[model samples]
Target: MTAVLPERVEVAIVGAGQAGLAASWHLVQRGVDHVVLERATAFHDWQDRRWDAFTLVTPNFQCRLPGFAYDGDDTQGFMTRAEVGAWLGRYRASFDPPLLEGVEVVGLTRAEDGFLLRTSAGELRAAQVVIATGGYHRPVVPPLGLRLPDGVVQVHSADYRNAGSLPEGAVLVVGSGQSGAQIAEDLHLAGRRVHLALGRAPRSARRYRGRDCIAWLEEMGVYDVTVQQHASGLAKRESTNHYMTGRAGGHDIDLRAFALEGMRLYGRLTDASDGVLRFAPTLAQYLDHADSVMESIKNDIDAHIARAGIQAPVEARYSPVWVPEEEPAALDLAAEGVTSVVWATGFRPDYRWVEVGVFDGTGHPTHRAGETDVPGLFFLGLPWLSTWGSGRFAGVARDAAHVAERLAARAGAPVPA
Candidate 1:
């Protein structure tokens, strides 16, 4: 049910996802008056955008929303897409936040007093606004995709549902990020012939020594590493996440192993024309880079284990199970009976509706931990907004709290004791 839109509120939070809800929780605790505007139903992205077989890449324990942490028995286990949606539902019910569903904020402009939000409902004014819609706004596909044969179906990773939904034939998945790798695996397991185009995204071990790599990284303070403290500086924010999977109790996504199992691997998809696709001659180089990254992570873990004198089980290091002999530069898609293409290319931010000057040249919001130079505006649920986990369930609570505190201070609201 849609909540009645208020004419004015002390705070207006755009997007009722994890970050927005978390911020709302904090604001409620502080006895602040705020309304959360959601374009769709709460947690709609988790339920709609994800594929049927999708599961969390991170462990269940990491789903730490403000005042509500994952309390399930399988703390180390990954939640399926349904489970994630249910969890978020439980969080919302626990708080009964003042939220309006089906209200899209189309434009945001500075008001004489604070800010004016032009929404599907009507104009609402607030003294402060929290932009927590997240970074994945628009799905991106290359212009080369337009040149593909008309018979071939093309879908972005966001729109991909399952293998059975596509035409019966070989499938080509472009990109090797988490979604790409996992989607390819899903198709392969479903008895579909899979051909994957590899990107520069590195792979990582799911588990090492006595724990999940994520757990080890948490212990090593990897997730807590702030964007400013990161060695790569702000560039780390744009880095592709290492590929792994939490499907079937977590495992590594070895493209090499997939290749051995009859999944045709190719380098980056360069161009498409006349029912044919061209690939770069860098399959071996890309694979080696992925392996080296995985090994480098393991090396760090080994060093940490030695330094901490932790007597965990010693394990054999990974050796390449398969290698590319010759880099295939071209594929006749029509001849190979390739029926569909899954472009797991990633997304670009779209804040064109936001008239605020808080964004940088790249259109990413310019903020320090969600606080923009504009006093009444802030951004949240962005990758590396504060730390490695800033955008994930593990760290959004902290970031939301930070934003809520700032918002409260700006509004002259006293935090609860």
Candidate 2:
């Protein structure tokens, strides 16, 4: 049974995921009375949504929340989905903040004093509100997906579990993001013929110069790049997903690697109609773009090593490899035995609960470093809110601290005073 929320709170945090918990820890330390509301019971997304064999793309070193950090021996290693869930469970036990689970927030309106929130449990008011719901909410699938044949099974990356769950046939994994790449690899390794639809996403090596690329990035403070301090205007936008996996303690997961593993690669999925699938014929171009991005990152790492005077052993540089599709622009899925489709496009922000004018045309909140134009209104755990690590556990503390400070100031209780 859901408990009735109090009439008012000093601060109210919605979505008790990593971001919400991090913000709650900061508020509790300052003796601020706040409540974290979560629609689900668990604290991390990996606990429920990801596949059984899923692990983090980056190493375990980046799994540091505000008051908690992974102290296991696998700092240089990637964490499996189960390991991540255990870490979050431990964090919940350690702090045990005032979190109300199974409380779905249905509506939020601006009250005269602060704000009014109508939830599944009950209605409540809050002087300050922090939306820690990270950006990945709604899956951004192309409308063309609905055009697939009725017999072809369709599932989004979030709903997929393992290769065994899929029917025995040629599977087409659409989108070349991290999930798509890893899923394709999983199916192929399971002895199933897989087809990958390529996109222009960046890729990263699992290790560089004998040291984990994640550690190298940390040493060079690459994750500390804030929106304003980024290399270019475009860099201020959200960063693309990495292409590394924890299989065999992590390895490069590029398109060429997948092809070498007996997986067929194709260009981006353009359309599907009348049992015919169309591809964009940009496979080579997409490969070149990804290769260029990887090269640039490696160059930066190399320059950083040289500047630090580290006597690290040199590693062979990556060479651009391409695999072209031999098939024509359009093909029949039934003819090729393709029976299932996995869409790994991406996600969009969902904020239908909050009835406010602060949102932009794209439904993205108009904020400067998590602070909205309205007083006592802030956001947390958003990508690029402050730095590259903003949404991840490694970088959430910085943004949480900033959000707490701003919230305190708005309530007439200045923090760090």
Candidate 3:
């Protein structure tokens, strides 16, 4: 049965994730009457999707929302998914943010004054709409054009938690990002013989006085660059790689090290048969590719430091974690009793529910911080919206404040308290 539709509201925000929550907090602080619609029962997606040993790459000190910060005493610490979820709950309580939970947004269409949002519950009309849903909504699996044999079990990283959840066998983890590396490490630790398909070797940070590389970026205003500044495309691409992985430290667990200890590193999977996985030679080439990228980043950082006349010592301390020198002559799958393949590739943004005509050529919504080309539409949680820091928890508040100010000005009201 179709539920009743609200005739009108001043603003309607979609997806109650971090971005949506941040936007609502700002809207309420400005006394802009708004309602947030979340499809889930709570902020359960990020919490539930994380693996058992997963933690934030960014430390807790940087995990602040608009009015609130992470309350824990550990400032130089990383927060687990559970801790992040708990903090989000506190953030929701602090503002009493008006959130309509379990209401999935199905479609959106342009209305005369603003937009009409159709949801699972019903319809909502609002003068302004903020699409604050994060980037990881859609999971991208390997483009295995050929059909796999029935004996092989395959699952995406989103559904994976631990080795126990995987089918019994030698496991092959595809992708080399934080998720893939961490999962490979965990499964190896659990006594499962593992194989990792290396895509790219990401530059890892060398710990300096027991702090992450991101802390330095925060201090250096690297995260403060915005689209308005006309930053180089290389700068934006490098920023994505820089923050994707964890650094080396006593607490740090290196995936390459884990692979050297037990797991086998293979190139891209070419094809698979009845329990047999084939690989290409590209894996060896990736090491050089990764090293060049890292070298470029190091040079860029050094140049930036020198140009800015900053005196802080810049250093690269950690060595690349060891991988096998040569590919194995033959990887015997039947001998090891391999059974499952976990695709830790990554996620893509799915905007099918978003029916508006604001996306760019690459299918990403084109916006300035949060303002869309369409006046009443806005976006949040996009990568490098204002600066490198704009997407992180520490950076989001400033963007939120900016969006709130713009919204108030559009409404012809003084900035809300």
- Which candidate leads in TM-score? 1
lDDT per model vs. reference: 0.92, 0.82, 0.73
Where does candidate 1 have its weakest 10-residue lDDT segment? 1-10
**Per-residue accuracy of model 2 over 10-39 as CA lDDT, tens digit each:** 899998888888888878777788899998
Give the per-residue lDDT of model 3 (tens digit) for 210-301.
Answer: 34556756766767776667547524523334324332211444555666687788887677655566778776676556655555655655
- Model 3 weakest 10-residue run by lDDT: 241-250
User: TM-score for every candidate vs. truth?
Assistant: 0.98, 0.95, 0.88
Candidate 1 vs candidate 2: the TM-score winner is 1
- lDDT (Cα, tens digit) per residue for candidate 1, span 1-417: 545789999999999999999999999999899999999898799977899999999999888999999978999999999999889999999989999999999999999999999999999999999999999999999999999988899999999999988999999999999999999999999999999999999999999987999998889988899999999988888999999999999999988998999999999899887988999998999999999999999999999999999999999999999989899999999889999999999999999989889878898888889888897899989999999989689799999989998888987897667
Candidate 3's clash total is 5
Error of 1 at 249 (Å): 0.7
lDDT of 2 at 306: 93
Q: How many clashes in candidate 2?
A: 0
The true-versus-predicted C-alpha distance at residue 244 of model 3, in Å, is 7.1
What candidate 1 gets wrong by more than 4 Å, as runs, is 1-3
Best by lDDT: 1
